[model samples]
Target chain A: MARTLITVPRTAKRDEIIEIRALVQHSMETGYRRSSDGDLLPRDLIRRFTCRFVPRVAANSNAASTAGDLIFAATFHAAIAANPYLSFNLRATTSGTLVFSWEGDNGLAQTETVSLLIA
Target chain B: MQPSTQALQKDDTQNPAMLWVKDGEALWNKPEGAAAKSCASCHGEISRMKSVATRYPAYSSTQRKVINLSQQVNLCRVTQQQASQWPADHESLLGLEAAIAKESRGLPISPPTQRQLADAQKHGEALFNQRVGQVDLSCRDCHETLAGKKLGGNVIPQGHATGYPIYRLEWQSVGSLQRRLRGCMTAVRAEPYTHGAKELIDLEAYLAKRAAGMKLESPGVRP
Candidate 1:
């Protein structure tokens, strides 16, 4: 629940679409476990996440959720490792910031914003 | 892929990441401590001490705490041999822990117990789901969302610890699972804890148990 990662590629070809992969640290506890004391541990996991991009090239060239949108959202399972990982693609653009965010099972959340540039 | 083929890809021990395992092995028996106590000097031939590494992050009633083998080893060095404890990411420590976990490949992961072990697990589970950092990403984000899907140029297989003490070419040496965990925390811009720290072990115990029924794969590899 406390760990996450964000990596924005240094450069991308204007026409080339590449995937951004990530993994986080969390137990994704299913609430089915008992501690050594035999008490139940509540279920907690990252429920969902999103990636977005906004154009910064020209002053008025903001990308819409439709065109430069990550558009892909994912739901992670509790059985996955701590710090679950994901990958999504973004359309190549001149310059922008790619935003990634996640919300977990027990109400935990995190977000990462990275700068991007396309030559 | 067929189930068997799928199984093979998921088996990290057999993956190319095992090069670090060999490195850890060389370091394990070599003597460099102040008291001349190599891991072999006290633990003996690790191959014969089956499963010791797999049951780590277990609770310790003697210390009223939960400790992993790495921390335990550090304790021994400081207390038993009058040597300074190595930092969690110290090459010798990571190499040794990775090697031990690697040796425990395919073994069972049983966490040690203490009076508060359950509470620790609960806290750790909460931490896993608790949101931190600006990323707002939880541990479940990738492993669960895209489990078994190819992501970021690699398969987002289940976040299982069949591999620990893995070899990351990126690290250029054996890496303790805690090291990877630390990487996660750092990426999220959270405060990083020392390797082999109790919090790290608790998280480790929780994840390994969650990954129960899966064979151990110490000294695993990943891109």
Candidate 2:
């Protein structure tokens, strides 16, 4: 499994834009490369990544909510180096959790989340 | 180096090595050793160490030899801090080295040029050009003659020591120049030198002199 690192501000003002950075540990093996034995190394890379912001809802509210709103997403390629890194900006509207997920070839997948407190 | 890797180096949040730097910062203030003297107790503010790393592999009158920053740190640990020496390439040692080097970032490489160091520097120059191992390749073969060319699908850099205690993506951790040099020896199938070996110290002297004008980028990121 690929290890991940995520960075998010611990606190932010309402409607403020905050930067989020993420990185994952992966070989990002491009099939174009050959091993010492002259055999082709199979391709393995994080093909996709997504970030979603799930706003905190009031406890008394009965509003229906799902997995949060998608804030950012990216599609990667084999050309990406090992340990893929991604960074983006998100506008904070309310206290919420940011969910980051990555998917790769050969069923490689990993997810991480961080909380953002708005004052 | 790839553009992406360079970008990672500039951004602390994205640079995995920063994690170690953070640990180093913590260790700096925290007391350790039998004397309970933390690095801060002696070194005071880290800012005082700025540009200190630029003049390493210097001649130590007491030791009667050239000593790199890592060795100096070990020396302090043993004598001043009253602590046992951390083994070579230990994470804690690398962390301290990274912290010290980080302070000197962007400074020029300026290893000492005293008369005492002349002989060791010559030995280092010879080692740099000498061919070794089954492949019979010398550091000059690639870093000098074949630099800017492809090697194993990656561009061969000038092999400057400008950035050390670097966070190498391959190793997925920060490491010292000696560790990287050992890796090079292994790549050429040569007998690797033990850490703190005189031969390695001599080679470091040569590299420091060769990279004299280059900027320091310790805790640098590389692919």
The alpha-carbon deviation from the true structure for residue B93 of candidate 2, after best TM-score superposition, in angstroms, is 0.6
Q: Count the backbone clashes (under 3 Å) in each candidate.
A: 35, 0
Ten-residue region with minimum lDDT total, candidate 1 chain B: B11-20
Model 1 CA deviation exceeding 4 Å by range: A1-119, B1-19, B31-34, B112-114, B194-197
Best by TM-score: 2
lDDT values, one for every candidate: 0.67, 0.87
Best candidate according to lDDT: 2
Fnat values, candidates in order: 0.00, 0.22
What is the TM-score of chain A, computed separately for every candidate? Answer: 0.80, 0.94
Best by DockQ: 2
Q: Which stretches of candidate 2 lie over 4 Å from their true place?
A: A1-6, A9-17, A22-89, A95-119
Q: Across residues B1-223, which tens digit of lDDT does each residue of candidate 1 receive?
A: 2454344335433333333345567767877557877768877897865787777667776677877777877887786566788886676676667667766667777655554777777767777776667776666776677678876566766677667766554554456778888888888788877765767777877786677567776665555
